[model samples]
Target chain A: MTLFPRAVNETTSRELRKTFRSPSEIFYPLIFFVLVLTMFPFSIPPVPGLFNSIASGILWTAALLAISLSLETLFKADYSSGALEVIHLSGANLVLVAIGKSLGHWIISGLPIALLAFPIGWALDLNFLTLWVLVITLMLGSATMSLTGSSISALTVGLRGGGFLLVMLSLPFFVPLLIFGSSAATNASLGIVPEAELYFLGGMFVLSLTVAPWATAHAIKIRLG
Target chain B: MSKPILEVTNISLSRAQKLVVRDLSFSVSGGEILRLSGSNGSGKTTILRALAGLILPDNGKVARLEEKLGNITTSSNSVIYIAHRHGLEENLSPLENLNFLSQVCTPPPIRDGVSVLETLGLKTSMHVPTARLSAGQKQRISLARLLMFDAPLWLLDEPFTALDTSSKKQLESMIDAHLDRKGAVVLATHQRFNCKSHVLKHSLPMIP
Candidate 1:
């Protein structure tokens, strides 16, 4: 109804439309995530115990890479088309638009990985409790990854070899999420509650959700300047 | 003239690690059209960007008159900027692109989207993706953005490129009509245009 909400909705709808229009953009990374998960059992022993021991690590690492893979398209089209400049000039709050785009990205790239973690974890012989912890942790970690990755992607949108730059810039931020996430699942397997790790991951998610959009807005401004 | 709608005072800008616009200054009053003419790499686009607040000046400031309160404002909300790039999503149809622009526009769109595209002579291809359109059509689609919003100042960079004679004249008339409504425009282009409004040609000195 109002400008801010309408602008955010418009941005989100455009992103969703773009993502679905070319479904490959959404499927490739997810397939990569699944393939990476599937490869772990063959490389290591095929034993159920061995598979369960390393399942969380494989999922987190693959999800991280998959999410990173999708980040390249986050702002590439808009920036190249000069739509970002037009939006900026139109007086739309860049922060809200950034958040909306990030949300669309999470839905396409992050949410699927998180939802698949359960079934994939089962295929890797993870128990019910560990599977639940894996799913919860992946959901939080993936959302946080998308948020932080959006910022890094925005910062690198104007640069050459930006994909490499995005990974380099985002890895440090991803480290904490990976640590807390994998540990939460591992702890759950070991009969520990993993509450503290989940809390830490949630805190990181909230913190990133707060800061990444603003940082993304600032990054885009600098790029345009 | 009632307080220049937009003012650039002693502003300087750099591109590719070199100063492009050096202490350049100009102002655009209501019902006036300021054309930025210069040779290649003369920073015409840079000056328009500075006026739009997309680029911060290395020195001095750009100010704009707020029509309601009669006070000078430097915020970006007062200006409408059309970059050299078409700014339309290649995957979207012309109508969809205008709808995209309408969401964030200041005064917002009261007119139907189809009529606006028709007025821009894009009625036939209104539903076709912009990527399939010709260069002139894309430029016309970008020009259609001007009608989606109502801002006191317009910063257009190289607006006439790829346009045929008739479309060029049509756009020139649109700019003239905008000027007649007491809106100001700072346009950067080499194409010569004749309009009834006060036309001032400011040339940028080439980088030494």
Candidate 2:
């Protein structure tokens, strides 16, 4: 068999197993996403119109924060345990490893957040079409965030206080995704087609999908050096 | 004599802007072992990492030679490196960890994880999480990779640390057998290797 699929498959499976075994990795960011989304209604004045209009913004912001939270430990565990070194020296394709990790991260964190956003968006007074739009936008946006965040996490893998550095480095890149994502939901809520914003989020997703893994692999090599 | 499996020519490696190994050179051939001995902070691990291609030498060449159709070609895939850390996942059992490794390692594992773990005397605890295993047991699991992969050149750092006498002896024999199979090893350690093979010692000087 060719090396590409096998390497990516094993790495991704290993990542999934590790994350599942440690329940906290799967639950913490999810709980944090719930908490952040729940806080919006209580903190703001109780106006149905205000909450409805801004629900998408609140959801997207919470997702961005939750993804960053999950990414803090992305490469730290592998680097500290020396698994990263073994993977690198084992002649496995580092780019494929990066891609596998991003896929695993999205499955555990991004996918859950996207699904949870649906019910949460409904509770926030979002219409059915708007709620659908929110979930779809989050699915696209959080994946893009995970991809971009993986590179940032890999870059700061071994640094002291890397979590803060990760958030700072990734926030600027996440802004465009957040904007496009929330805009799509808001437009849907307002009865507009929302096609333009959805297309922008899709474009960003494709861009990050192509570039992030390579950048993450390079970052890993640099961090190791 | 067989062609050298690995060659290092005038390599200098530095860490954090400080030169750790300066103008060092060495080579290892089949059925041979290169032992790197040095005090702490003397750059033995750095040199091993450089040989493993994990770290690029600031100034020289480290090459792995493969005989292809009677011609030698430089190939980096023939080496396996074990670092100071055991690289075990705390949550995974030894069997699970090794099973994952067997699939990911290049050329794949010649021997399965269960037999290797059994040989390491971890038959009873193979299913226990690695965090529950003692340091010596974890070290044995790390060294299990030596048996798992068929790479010709092994770069091991402190492979003896945390091992009990019997386990240490077990590792020595494993190394000896690998050499007997025409494989090469470059090891960094403090304990004297109790194997019958002739070990060429390269002592690294402590850099000021």
Candidate 3:
């Protein structure tokens, strides 16, 4: 096999193993996501139509926050511990490393949130078709979030108060994703196909997939310097 | 003497807007050990990083030479750099970390992870998480990369820190063995250690 795929495989597997070993890394964001979704119903009045009407917004917002929370430490540990330097010096392509890290983040954070949104949507009285649309939109939107967040995380890897900085820098980029993802779900709830919103999310995913890893590699280099 | 594997010419490096290395120039060839010695803030690490291609020189060039069909060609895979921080994950075992590193290495590692750990006297603790390992043991695990990868140029930054006497001696011998294979080393350290090769000391003047 060529070097790129092999390097990506090792990096992704290492990332997966590290995530698994630290239960809190996986659980904290997940718990935050669940809690945020769970508390929304209690905070709002007991209007059945209101809950269903706002379910898509609440679920997407929770996912976005949970992802941002998890992204705070995405590159911090690796950068401070010198793992990033070693990998870069080892002749492994940093672009591939970025891809692997984003993939791992999507698996742990994005995938779980997407799957869990189904049950949460059910609890919120969303219909079957809308729940599926929520899951699908989240799967695409969260992966894009992970990609965009990876670059920002690398940019702010070692700065003081970088967590808050990451959330701020990333939030602007995430607005479009949030708009389309929630709109898609909301339209699906109203028996609309939501094709345009889905297409937009898909386009953003492909665009970020192509650009984010390269940007992340450069960001890491700059931070290391 | 073999052709120079690395050359840094008139390189001026600045960290955080202050120049740390000013027009510094050096080169390392096969079977040579270039020791960078200086007091704190003298830019030994900066110079080493410049040589490793991690930091670009504002005024000069850093080049790595490779022999391709009897001609010297510039290449990147010639250097292996070990920074101050041990790159092993806190949660992963030494074996797992080494395995991951080996896979990422361009040319696959000649020596397996287990044998390299055994050579470093870390066989028993290879399965334990690196966070539980003592400083010296963790340092040994980081140094294990020397034996695993066959990169011709090794750039080590403060590699002697936290290493016990025996481990330091072992590292010196490893340097000797690597020199025996006609490989070059550019090391930055404060500790005194002996190697069989003729060591060239380059002191970076403290930036005022």
Q: What order do candidates take by TM-score, descending?
A: 2, 3, 1
Best by TM-score: 2
Query: Candidate 2 — which residues are off by over 4 angstroms?
Result: A1-4, A41-48, B67-77
Per-residue alpha-carbon lDDT of candidate 1 for residues B1-208, written as tens digits (9 for 90 to 100) = 4799987788778987899988888877898888888998998888877777767777887777753312222233567778899888887788887787677555566566788888988889998978899999899888876776667788888889999999999988888888889999888887777788768889889988
Please write out the lDDT profile of model 2 over residues B109-160, one tens digit for every residue: 7789999999999999999988899999999998887877778999889999
lDDT of 1 by residue, A1-225 (tens): 355477678887888876676667768878989887777767886665776687788889999888887888889999998988877776667888888888888888888888988887887778889989988898888889888888889889968888888888888879989898999988888888899999999999999989999999888877877
Residue-level lDDT tens digits of model 3 in B1-208: 6579877778888998998989888888889899998899999888877777776778877777743212212123577788888987899999999898777766677899999999999989989988899998988898887888778889999888898888889998888988999888999888888889789989889889
Ranking 2 against 3 by lDDT, winner? 3
DockQ in order: 0.56, 0.54, 0.56
Clash total of candidate 3: 0
lDDT of each: 0.82, 0.85, 0.85
lDDT of 2 by residue, A49-168 (tens): 887778788888998999998897778888999988777766667788888888888889999999998887777678888988988898899889889999999998878888898899
Clashing pairs in 2: none
Docking class of 2: medium
Lowest summed lDDT across 10 adjacent residues in model 2 chain B is found at B67-76
Candidate 1 segments whose C-alpha is farther than 4 A from its true place: A1-4, A38-49, B67-77, B110-112
Give per-residue CA lDDT, model 3, range A1-225, as digits (tens).
255487677777888898788787677878999888888878999976887788899999999999988897678788888988877777667888898899888889899989999987898789888999999999999999999899999999989888999999999999999999999998999999899999999999999999999999889878876
